[model samples]
Target: MSDPVRPGAVRAATLTRQPAFWVVAALLAAGAVRIAQITGRFLGVYPLATVTAMLLFALLAVPFWLFLSELDFLEREPASLRILAFAWGGLVATSVSIPGSNSLENLIAKLGSPNLAADWGAALAGPTVEEIAKTLGVVAIVLIARPQVNSVLDGVVYGALVGLGFQIVEDVVFAVGAVAQAGQGDQIQPVITTFLVRGFLAGVWSHTLFGALAGAGIGYLVVNPDRTRAHRLAMAGLALFGAWASHVLWNSPLFREGLGDGAVALLAVLVFKGLPPLLLILYLVRRAHDSEAAYYVAKLADLRDPVLITDGELRVLGSGTRRAAARRHAAARAGRRGRAAVRRLQRAQARLAVELSRDADPDLRHSAEVQRQRTALTELGHPEAVEGDPSWRHTVSTVGTTVVAVAVLWAALSFLGNG
Candidate 1:
């Protein structure tokens, strides 16, 4: 998955000795302190609205956190580093961008006229300042923990978390701002409206998605040592530009103004601005995850131990879809415990692959764990080595899922149209 830091590669400077570690640490601390002050003031001024905003965004963060953390299941990024990336976005990037975007917007007004600033300042300045700042959160991870970022998907996960952090905090600020503007006396209607519009409607294509696009570039830059440095840098630059352009378009009213009034037109504008990047990021995630799963599953195949991972299981292990189908098959065969056992076996097999990659099994540590999981499967009469559902079943399920997804999309769009 990450040939750049393969076993026996030249070791980077250790964390204690790296000056970049201290620099990042100092910046994070300062950002946290500043954010805390601002949050304190916001609460003091509008306790109900502030609390409502925080609760809504905090709940929203859970699914994003779980999904991103699990993207690279074969070699999941460590929790601490993921949290660090989020903090960098929530605390550091948001803190910097508040003043930075404002300053840049003022400069634009001075140079291009107030009318220009009013029309385009947020589109230009916010993305310009915030994207760079959020991108640096990924950079900070690479600088501080180079070994942890050995996959493009790693960058995507970290970037998504950072963007998620920024998004939640920025949205809270905006929710409060909306409250202040409404002069609603700390009522929660604005907070709820903000939650639906920002956290529900636009959340999927907002900062988190942008961060992931940029993070994929950083991951490529770090992991793909086979390419020329110039070529790698160019790809990374292109990814970042794509992220910025997507953000600018999402923020800009230039296109929305032409879409005219009414919810139908507004829905069209939202889809036009958001859908391309959503598709792009989905494609990237699938591509990266499949490549990673293949690499690790191959490692498991080398051992040729059915107890650890059977041939049937090997086929399923390399694909997330098959893995899920296998679990469903187990549930039908046995029950709830059977489903759980199959899941455990799959996870154990994946972990064994990770350990096998390093040849660090002098004592058969990870192998023993896989065997234990296998034994549990045996007890439950649901061995981890069953052929998955037939191609026809998969085709039916795929079509069913697509139909459901389309139905949901139509429902959401109709709701927005009615709004």
Candidate 2:
């Protein structure tokens, strides 16, 4: 009996050790492979060229990802679902739409005249089909992951990611095509420059922006499902109209003529055309963020804790300085544990705050109340302190509005100057 028991215990210990060994081995293998690939790719090329391009892509993509992630706080959805939204845009949507549009254009050309086909391709094919296709990605996201999309901002962010993905892939193909067409002795500098300008700057307003605008309408429709059919139809119409208008203005020959004259035309398009819609979207996002903050603050009022969250504390929650101070205070008291708790509370508070801002159903209100109480118990000790004042809410709203307005104004002016 003793011999059998001893062997069993040893076997169990070995099994546990095996998993740990394998995990470490796998990680080491992955790292080694990555290093080898990087070294081999850069061996003959310019020392820092590949590295520089990667860094540039990271710089551009990371901010866009962060912006979308932040807006996600308002909706309270899973990251996986959000990514799925982007994947659908890039994969299924792009694949089907591109081929379908090409087929249709070819058919039209054969039936009519080649010049007529070219005219239709320029005016209708690019704007109508591409916008519809990209916007469908946003719609699919809303359909499949309804909970993830709460506002127009969410639509914009997701739509933008999809568009960005499409644009990046398309640009790569264009660059390679240019190189191939130019034949053996041609310099690739012109192709590279074209990729930078068209893929980076103009990409911002391309398919992604249009999809976002349309997505906002879709999100609004879904959010307000109780509306009359006529109202929903009207909103849908508006969304599609907004998307097509943006696409048309972006692809139109008027702007193309300006590019030849100087940077002025490009500047005009960016400022007068691009800045206004972007500003409008930002304004809407600010409102959503403020509303979310107010909801959580209100929920805390019911907790009755001792670490009284004053109107001032609520104000601090809205401002970066105040949040930092809270983190410092918590960290000082509890060290690492306290800091972690503070961060968790901050996120919880933000979520509950957003929930409270909306006139929630009874079930939602009750759920939020319970969560608020629990969070208060964990962080502030039981009976969490709560102070009431509507003015604090106003202050937060005012600050957010002012900040967004200033940003829009600055961008608009910069665009105008460039034009």
Return the top candidate by lDDT.
1
Model 2 residue 326 distance off true place after TM-score fit, in angstroms: 8.7
lDDT of 2 by residue, 1-419 (tens): 00000000113344335554344334335534543454354433433333343344445566666666765442444565456555555454555555667777787788887887776555555667766766666666554445456554556567666666556444543444444465543445535444455555665666666766776666666555567778876986797787778776665555554554434555566566666556655565565456544445555565453343445556656544456555555554545665556555556555554444444432454455545544644664322222223345447878999999767545644543443
How many clashes show up per model? 0, 12
Task: Show where candidate 1 strays beyond 4 Å.
Answer: 1-17, 260-262, 360-363, 385-419
As a whole number from 0 to 100, the lDDT of residue 154 in candidate 2 is 59
Cα-lDDT of candidate 1: 0.85
lDDT of 1 by residue, 86-123 (tens): 99999999999999999999999999999999989999
Q: How much does each candidate deviate from the true structure in C-alpha RMSD?
A: 3.2, 13.0
The TM-score that candidate 2 achieves is: 0.62
**Full-model lDDT for every candidate:** 0.85, 0.55
**Local lDDT at 11 for model 1:** 35
